[model samples]
Target: MDFVHRKLEPPDLQDCAPQGTKVTDTDPRMIYHGEMIPVGTPDVAQGLKDARRALRTNRFRPTGRRKSMIIDGCAGKTTLLLQIGRAYQGLLETERRPDSEWTPVVYINVPPRRESNLDWSLPFADFFGMDHTINIDKRTYRSTDMTEPVAHAMRESRTSLILIDGIDRIHDSELTTAFDYFDCLQDRLRVSVIYCGRGAIDIVNEGLHNRRRSDRPGASEQFRSSLPVMWIRPIPFQKGQEEGWRTVLQSYDDNLRLYNHQPGALLELDEELHERTRGYMDTLDQLICQTAQQAIEDETEAITKEALDDMRVGRNEPDDDWA
Candidate 1:
């Protein structure tokens, strides 16, 4: 999975068809809808810049302010993290020796909370493809605490960065142990960690505050002091942000595979798109991609305002005005 992930790149406009050209291939056109469109929004651009600097400064440092980053937002957090990861992996491929087994970056989602004692190292073990369980007998097996072995694997692989998504899903009670595991990884492995999720700042700050109160030394003082956070919010429709928002729409417009879409069709609906999606990037994507698919199904082969209006997949219900 790591190998496949490293090989995967964000979908490109060339993956489908040139603008104003017909996209008759059913599979490719449909596949484009599910692809994460890599619009170079300011937030994403800034994230890449920060991630590069963190990876560079944290290199070979044994301790002190590893410069970890937390990307916090209600939306686009995971997408931005994945984008950074892909870019990081691409750069690693060029520097790595052909014989090296190093997997410089590890990306994993925070696993769901468990009823029993959660082995916080499980996600890392899974990422490294290590067995986290030991066979006690022919028909019996026990879960092995893989904290040491997973760290060993990371050391062997020479992993420099770890990208963790879905930090918000961890229950408050589980934060200490999970973060303790992470703290250990950073301190022992000397790896820079980047985390992503909604409300991540409050969640992590509260965890650190609780740890401080309890006098646990696991949450490193460096992490508490030097962790930099970048918030990724939806582009607002207000003045001064109009160009950015329209540029995003222009990117989508430029990539649409619809046969009859005009060059500036989506750009013209920037305001209406914002109104429909309330500036949520994911919802805006859903509106355009789903409407494009609907157009293809109905043989229109082009997105129209009427088709967009018929789609009701926003995160919130439409207001009475839109309804």
Candidate 2:
């Protein structure tokens, strides 16, 4: 079967009044709430730009350099990764043929392994709908190495970018083999790769440790001392730093579908929102999305301080005092 990667589509939301959106007996607004509304927060926007630049530069290169994006806290790395992927895909939509099966990008979440052995190629095979498993018995199976076929499929599909997420979940013992597979993929496919996770820096460092240096004269001098890295840290709520936080809140406000919500409602409570979410995008997203959904159900049609305070979402760390 030919696997055509579907582009990540944002929900087609109606203007602000989610209560009025009728898809079935259930409110269609629930679908919107289920998605992570892409906000162009400062860090996210910068990350997107860097990722795009890397992909564009490596589009026609014989070998692509690896890039890494590290998140200081584990709040929203996956969301940022998706945003970057979606943005890059959007850029290619104009150039992609109408009937083309060309999947310019591939996304994989590194699965947590119980043992040191992992079939790194399985993810790619799964993405492209290739059979990478061999039947061991009537009820048992083993994954066959699909690296070569996977690489060929990627090249055939004209895939230029690969996004690897959840690298932190990979066991330390498996890091060498995991990155080795990636290095092979990049060398063979000549595709731009963005490694993302909290431990992304370490992963990149390990991969670069034994990387083959070009034998061309002056190549060592031309090589970068460090891999390209982007950090996605939380927006601070301090005086000067507060603007980014406010901007993010304002984005949620703009996208919210509350009928009675006044303009700048969320912006006015930026400080409180920051205090509640500690400027963490994940927590902030959960808080706002849940609150908006609640307001809709309650017919309040507005986000209030009490409603915000009452909403409980996100993990509660021991040091967390945001309650």
Candidate 3:
């Protein structure tokens, strides 16, 4: 038997955006909403591949170690996580029968709290469509933990993987404890896990080492040795990649009603915008969306350099000291 080789195409940007959206100066949803274009930088592509591989491998054979993906803020870290979840869910939808009870992946945004042991397990219970309850008693032997049900539900559901976001939200004092909690979950559940965050990986490693030395003698070595760290760098539109930027802008215009501008028209200003925003995707999106909103307010169909400059005015202050 002969098999045909076929190439896959990128998804339509309109499909990625909200249905029939309109933008105004007062309404920034078009710019800030969850709509995302997968730029597919090499780093992001590899990160997704590694995550899928780990999940696939762990599903059949248990892997007690978790995976870590470190992506800096504003570099499309959330987008990467969403894409991974979507892809895994799509696979589940296709491969599993309608009545099957397997949940291949679960994505959770770690809450902003010092202690998140219960917060972490709640999402797991919710994802498994199970009820969780805690029972307490004054007697020392009668206390009941809520996470037991969540863990049982996860195992019953055949949950193979978990994607955690916002690992950086753990308070400094509780960071080590949080890592220990996650490590315990991995060991107990035997599920593949991936964490996305800014700068928590190094701290997590250090915390693991401290725990191994002071508390659990075998804690850090296994985790630190087996877990692989993947970094996703910022994607910038470089020279010869004008077409990529054009597709992105065209997607924005088609979805957000920005200036009713054609892709070619947007491409004409690419160089100027690139120079201004340094091709940072978030900044570029903000610049174009805000500039187009300004142009619309001025009753103009075209976005000029003046509009770009005016939109950027008073917004030049650095939001952070780090790039």
Worst 10 residues of 3 by lDDT: 1-10
**Window of ten residues with lowest summed lDDT in model 2:** 212-221
Local accuracy of candidate 3 as per-residue lDDT tens digits, 1-323: 00011222333445543434444534443343233333555566777787678656656674445444444444567767767766666666677663445555677777654365665566665556555554457434322234787676667766666777876665556766677777787787776666777654545565556432234334322545335666655445777756655666555544444434454666667666666666466676677666655555555645676677666523242232335
Error of 3 at 4 (Å): 29
- Candidate 1's clash total is 0
lDDT of 2: 0.69
lDDT of 2 by residue, 62-138 (tens): 54354434432356777678777777777787776534567888888886542322478788888888887778767
Clash statistics: count for each candidate:
0, 1, 0
Q: Rank the candidates by lDDT, best first.
A: 1, 2, 3
Question: What C-alpha lDDT values do all the predictions have?
Answer: 0.73, 0.69, 0.58
Which residue pairs of candidate 3 clash? Answer: none
Report the lDDT of model 1 for residue 25.
Answer: 38
- What overall lDDT, based on C-alpha atoms, would model 1 receive against the true structure? 0.73
Best by lDDT: 1
* Regions of candidate 2 where Cα sits further than 4 Å from its true position: 1-25, 62-73, 98-100, 114-118, 210-225, 315-323
Q: Candidate 1's residue-wise lDDT over 1-323, tens digit each?
A: 24424432434446655554544536566666655355677788888898887777777565684767888875788877887777777777788663346777889888775323336778778887787777776788767677787888889888878898988887767777777777778888888788788767656666555543234434333345336887687887787768878888888888776667789999888767888888788888888878887776666878777887888976654453655
Clashes of 3: 0
